[model samples]
Target: MTVVIETRDLGKTYRETVALADVTLSLEKDTIYGLLGRNGAGKSTLMSIITAQNFASTGEVRVFGEDPYENAAVLGRMCFVRESQKYPDDFKPGQAFAAARMFFPNWDQDLADDLVKAFLLPMNRRIKKLSRGQLSAVGVIIGLAARAEITFFDEPYLGLDAVARQIFYDRLLEDYAEHPRTIVLSSHLIDEVANLLEHVIVLDQGRVLIDASADDLRGRAVTVVGDASAVSGFTSGREVLHTESLGRVTSATVLGTIDAAERDRLTAAGLDIAPVSLQQLVVRLTQKEEVR
Candidate 1:
């Protein structure tokens, strides 16, 4: 796999606040990455630094194996759709599309037009006058239509309803299948975008917490449910993420995979096993006092 973007011990600070700390990771080409984290987890900070919109306080960032800051060749191959992307007061959705078409070498006007129609965006309305959902649509359209070699979508679904968000996801997958590129999606709605991620990079407290393939991360944890005593006995010596008890019944979520033999043992002990979803695992892992 080709590493399109690489960062080494990246650190960012503003006075006393540290936005990112000693973060290092690689983004492979043609893969969809889910940048999952809480509101202040440094997801946007990391993307901003990589895109050269913001500078790192310490460490290095390389795009296409070269510094991205002020590098037109590298910057031109990337697109950043920010949650609060700014636009000219007088510019309309159509004008924004036109501007993007000229700036991105791989811009697809047909796709942009289709997306405009799909989202029911008003072409001639001033951007400042558009609804929040409409504003989000404009960003989503440009990001997908640009088809940049590396695209960063930092919470691009803001203000979008469930149906509209689904539309964005569906169209993204369809276009991606035809024109493959690196996509980094930063979102608090982890489960909604979980299926679209080939790889997952989770940040917490301005540091890298988990970096792994989505498939591998999926099997990294499991939930066991049954009688409180049985579940507690089985979870002994394991890393338990969370546990809840209702009377004599208990459900315990724990880290680590269960082999066939373990499964049989759990069944024999009258315990029920359940698969943990990506969102559940992330929530548990990032919680301050959950792991035990």
Candidate 2:
């Protein structure tokens, strides 16, 4: 696979405020990437810069081996879906779909039509007259139907109900299986998207904090539960992220690869070993970054 996008020492500033800094990163072709971070952590800013919606104060960005700044070749193959998708006040859902069809090279009217019915969106109604959930459906429909080679979804499930959100996930997976493309999803719904993402890039305080395969990140930490003394002895020199105790029993979440030998030793000490969720790992990692 080829590198779909790359950034070198990317930095952005607004007067005295730094929105992004020293952020060198790469995204590969035909992969699902989660741009996870807290608010004001540069997820949106980075996306804006890459899509040429904003400029960087320093560094460079390349999309499909060329600059994306007002470049029609690059922009035409990219689709950016966000909660705040805007249109003229008098524009209707039908008009929005028409415009997307004309703009995107790989637009799929069949898929768009199916999505419209699936989401129960009103075609003739003005976009401004639609409910929040209905409005989100319009963006989701365009994002999926456009079939852009590089798709960026920034919190696209804003007002969707549980069922509607699941529908979006199911459709995305179904379509992606048939048409592989590079996708960057910036979202705060960590645990929900953990299973969908093939790679993870965690940002903190306007810098890259964690970048690794989802499987590797899953194994980066482990939780151990056992007697307080035994747990203490086992984790004596390790980095303990979080700990809890009740009477003589204690549970500790620690960072590092717990090997087979260590697992056996933990079992021998009557300790239970468990896998750490991606959400928990991200939370701990960001908290640690804050402390530093």
Candidate 3:
């Protein structure tokens, strides 16, 4: 239950636009966290600030119980891998891995070499000449091999094919099991990594919309479908997230757990209750908070 990263009233702004606002979050140690949000929802900005690659306009952040800015002692234990990670124009995958091996204290050369082969990276070719997927592969290889205590990957699977994406997921899980660490993965491919996440933090329009464990989020919302009258009656006085109606049929999504008594009542009302998918819940939660 030790906290690895924590922020208080964190805010980041650019001229007239605010990228992050009054964000307070606590990330526990040795757990996989999914930092999910739509594009422009401040996921990357938050990651950059936490990694000390960018400065926050206001508020404070602590990594490993100390300030991270220019603190090599703390920064050395963290790695931030993103699609925008640039290498010298002439540097190749092999060169990048060699450099990472020197920077990260826990770098695993064997893992790096195996990943290079699995990714089929052209070690001889310049990084600038690689395709998008190839470039993404380079980032993934470095991320896994770095073995930092805290690693943040911001959409590092940009152009990977389904097969390559699966490989990344497989390797990440395999490695994490053997050497547990705090990992924050920010990706738009929600359903793909939904099961991999132990906890999820969702941002919407510069605000933290949802932060909860995967298990708790699973039952945080439920959808019921049936006759319009029955569905309406069942969801009344409850926190309805989303609702749709077609003729006399209606389906409504409500936020809150339905315990035994509520479940029995719903069953008696002839309403069929279905569990909500994580993707569906996030889509509803960050979807402008539609009025039912």
Candidate 4:
């Protein structure tokens, strides 16, 4: 796969605090990536630097094999839509769409028009006066309508109802099917978008915790439940993310897959093996970072 964005030894600092530290990752072309991490894990700061909205303290970033800062050719092909995006107080939804139309060469007015209706966005309401849902709709509409090559949506569904969020997802998938572009979605609503991700990148404490294919990530961890002593013995010397015991029964989430022999051992020990979801694995991974 072609690498659309590459960062090498990236680091960002603000005074005495490190926001991003020695991070290196690549985003492949024409793929959907779920950027997952807890708050203050440097997800936002990483996005800011990738979009060239902020400078990194160390290392470098290349978008399309060139710097993104003040590079119009690269900047015009990418759009970063934030959850708390601000516009001119007097501007309306139509004005926002018009500005995006002028900015993105691939902007589709027809699609923008259709999305405005689908989102039920008021054309004349001042952006400052719109409700939170409406504001989110504005961002979603722009992010979708712009049709940029690399689009970054930073929690773009905030304040949107379930139905509206679904609309955004549906529209995104439909459009992406027609025009495959690289998309990075940073969201806390993991399960909701789990199926849409082709790849997953997890950040913890300003570091890259995990970066791999979503399918591989799903099989990286498994939960074993059985007698406490047996389960503990089975998981001994392995990476355990979480463990719980209810009387004689014990359930443990362990990092690493079970092979043929291990599976036989688990079965002989009467332990039940359960698959772990992407969301559950991420929670355990980040939560496990708390005490370290």
Clashes of each: 0, 0, 0, 0
| lDDT value for model 1 | 0.94
Query: Per-residue alpha-carbon lDDT of model 2 for 54-122, expressed as tens digits?
Result: 999999999999999999999998999987988888999889999999999899999999999989999
Candidate 4 structure quality by residue, lDDT tens digits, 1-292: 8999999999999999999999999998999999999998999999999999999999999999999999999999999999999899999999988999999999999998998899898898999999999999999999998999999999978779999999999999999999999999999999999999999999998999999999999889999999999998988899999999999999999999999898998999999999999999999998998867
- TM-score for candidate 2, residues paired by index: 0.96
Best by TM-score: 1
lDDT of prediction 4: 0.94
- Kindly list the per-residue Cα lDDT of model 1 for residues 77-190, writing each as its tens digit: 999999899999999999998999999999999999899899999987999999999999999999999999999999978779999999999999999999999999998898
Q: What do the candidate models score in CA lDDT, each in turn?
A: 0.94, 0.93, 0.92, 0.94
Q: Indicate the worst ten consecutive residues by lDDT in candidate 1.
A: 283-292
lDDT of 3 by residue, 234-260 (tens): 878988888999998899999988889
RMSD of each predicted structure: 1.2, 1.3, 1.6, 1.4
lDDT of 2 at 62: 99
Every model's TM-score? 0.98, 0.96, 0.96, 0.96
Relative to the unseen true structure, what is the C-alpha lDDT of residue 117 in candidate 4, on a scale of 0 to 100? 92
